[model samples]
Target: MDMRKMFGFLFGLMVSLWLGVSLALAQSGYPQPTATTLNDFAHLLNANDAAAITQLLTDLKNEHGIEGTVVILNSIHDYPTGDDTIEAFATHLFNTWGIGDKADHKGVLILLAAQDRKVRIELGTGYENQYNDEMQQIINEHMLPAFKQGDYGRGLYQGTRGVIATLTGIWPPDERPVQSGGGSNSPTPVTTASSSRERSDGRMGILIFGAFVVIVGYLILAHIFGWPVGNSRSDDDDDYHSWSSHSSSSRSSSSSSSSGSSFGGGRSSGGGASGSW
Candidate 1:
């Protein structure tokens, strides 16, 4: 073919591929979030439960500067692109929606695919790797029981509460108080010292493990070189300090939202845990 015809054909092929990809992505079965905190597309939560969960998440964001959202879908397999596992779907949706601050990366997504009997707690890059265990614990201790009993609303609410507790070190009221005119109710504020204790224990465990590794490494090096091992110091304190400093500095400021408010443009690198009931 002539150069002109060849170039034209190549351009046409590129355009066709681009259009096809765009169309496929557009029909990927991800629902647009209408509310900032909750998108109950599966109709798993009742009006009260939904409102309560929304209020809980809204308060969490405003007070603690952590952006969180919950999504409920009937089944991923119901759509052409929903055939993927819950983990992939949650990660894609979380990044696509930008659930938290782009700079802070403090976003969390609680995804429930009801028909599939699967759930995922997707955390942003801001969270530590160890939180995966904590997320799994939340699913196992708080969520799975309700799910097995077919109490989806309870399961989701409890799961959300567990998430909030884990992140904030405080649990809000279990239910939102009644409001006038059927508007969003404000739950009475409550606090507890238990979650804080739990977080401290987790941190202590990590520090101990780190120190143990450091000591073992020092012993091994000393033995190899036939050097004295009278004294050794660990910089675990510095490491822990740096981690806390980063977490505090990277928190994104929360802004008020309405029904039309969207996510905060944050991204996640698939840091979370998944479960099946």
Candidate 2:
């Protein structure tokens, strides 16, 4: 019984106790064992278990042919409790639904659909405001009603349906559900020119902003160096205009003298010719 030995024993005891508690909580929380995902879906499909077959069919419904989605969220708080929290439930959902693993860093997942137009929701137990209960509420009030009334095929059809509209600022009325499509007959939505234009314009705006910054820097540098902005011609201080004027005057004088000499020579030639002939 030295102090160091006692401390070490206490630490070990705490770790063991925490693990036991977590295991217990998980069992109580989800009495049935967690089912495998698509990775295990294929195996379950071939497996003889009735329960496994049902889960696979559920996966098919959750992971059907949806693509191009959007989601917006304000905030979500994460529970610091052990793995038995809502986060665990969410991980289970994502796996069954074929949504990839995601970080629970911010309790909020403003999930912008990467490729598949399906929405996946995850809530952390840490958030009191956004605990599993609230999420269940969203599912029950907003989500489930759509599914039950519209039919799984007709309801959101897929997770992305209503969520996409919400992101696009056109969420269906509270009572309505998103339409579903599958196989070859489903009509693909044609994106309007305006949205395409907006995307292009957003890119152009970035480029233009960058160019403007460069031009401003160029002007500042030019001002500092006393260089002209564009196409500048510098004049010499050493009589550039004066030199041109002086040269022109000299040329005029020479021309006048030449003319006078030619006239005098012509007159002399005429007078001398009369005498010599």
Candidate 3:
């Protein structure tokens, strides 16, 4: 019994490890593109100075023929734009750069001057879940390698590279549908549908597996403790013997003993006759 439980524990551990590795490989681990260097990317758009942001986006659509939009925000309800304001910048960018005619597709943010402003890039709903922290880090760390030496176009290249990789793997690549060829006609926004489903399935699987493990563990503990779920008295009664020495046997025994007592007399007449003679 003890050995059985140990085996179960080991099996569960192996399954969990496999699941983790599979998830990592599926989401992250995108090969970094070598065709264009981040520096070269920066120069393509020439987005070091204030006007470079606009040029970088134009280059993405015209040169690379990428299909997407860039979002930017000026201000919102006097919300202080600071280093901690990632959401504010993202929101502003979404509205300003998200829907535009400048790129004929999507525009990656140049972040021309946002020292006090928080900066973020959202990949239409399509890439929101696909573009995870790994991809985001590539942009933050390498795209803008050095604030002094880096250009905004480099950041766009790195960030958009992640997006393009994801789209190529999952959706159509080599052809920018949403950017041209009647793909941009629709204004109805897209949602992150696939990720939501995956998240829901993941949570449910955890709950189910957790519940199963707990139940099995409890049963194992009870077996070792000798706990019973029902009464044991019925089993004991089935093995009992019947008492057959009833009062009928006692009545016959008493009659035999009484008759013997009355018949047990000595003959005294013979002794009296001998004395008279």
List candidate 3 segments past 4 Å from native. Answer: 1-84, 96-113, 148-153, 156-166, 169-277
Candidate 3's residue-wise lDDT over 1-277, tens digit each?
Answer: 8887777667656655665564443333111111211212112232232133334344554555543443322222122334234443443433332322223323222232222223344433323344446445645564444223423333444444444444344322222212223221122222235334434544564565456445444443433343342333234222121111222343466466444222111111100000000
Q: What TM-score against the true fold does each predicted structure earn?
A: 0.61, 0.25, 0.29
Could you give candidate 2's per-residue lDDT for residues 1-277 as a string of tens digits? 4785666556655655664564444333211112222221111112222233233323332453111211211111111224332334334322322332122222222121111222234422223243344333444444444433423222222332333333233433332222234221122222344334434544564565456445444443443343565545465433344444544775687477544112110000000000000
TM-score, model 1 to reference: 0.61
Q: Whole-model lDDT for model 2 versus the true structure?
A: 0.31
Taking every candidate in turn, the Cα RMSD to the unseen true structure, in Å, is 22.2, 39.2, 41.1
Tens digits of per-residue lDDT, candidate 1, 1-277, equal 4785666556655655664565444444455566879887655566888888898898988999999998877666554445479998888888777899888898899998876788999999888464898899999988888777666667778899999888888977788444344323122111234324334544564565456445444443433333455444355455445444543443332123233657788988999899998
Between 2 and 3, whose TM-score is larger? 3
Full candidate order by TM-score, most accurate first: 1, 3, 2
Cα error, candidate 1, residue 160 (Å): 0.7
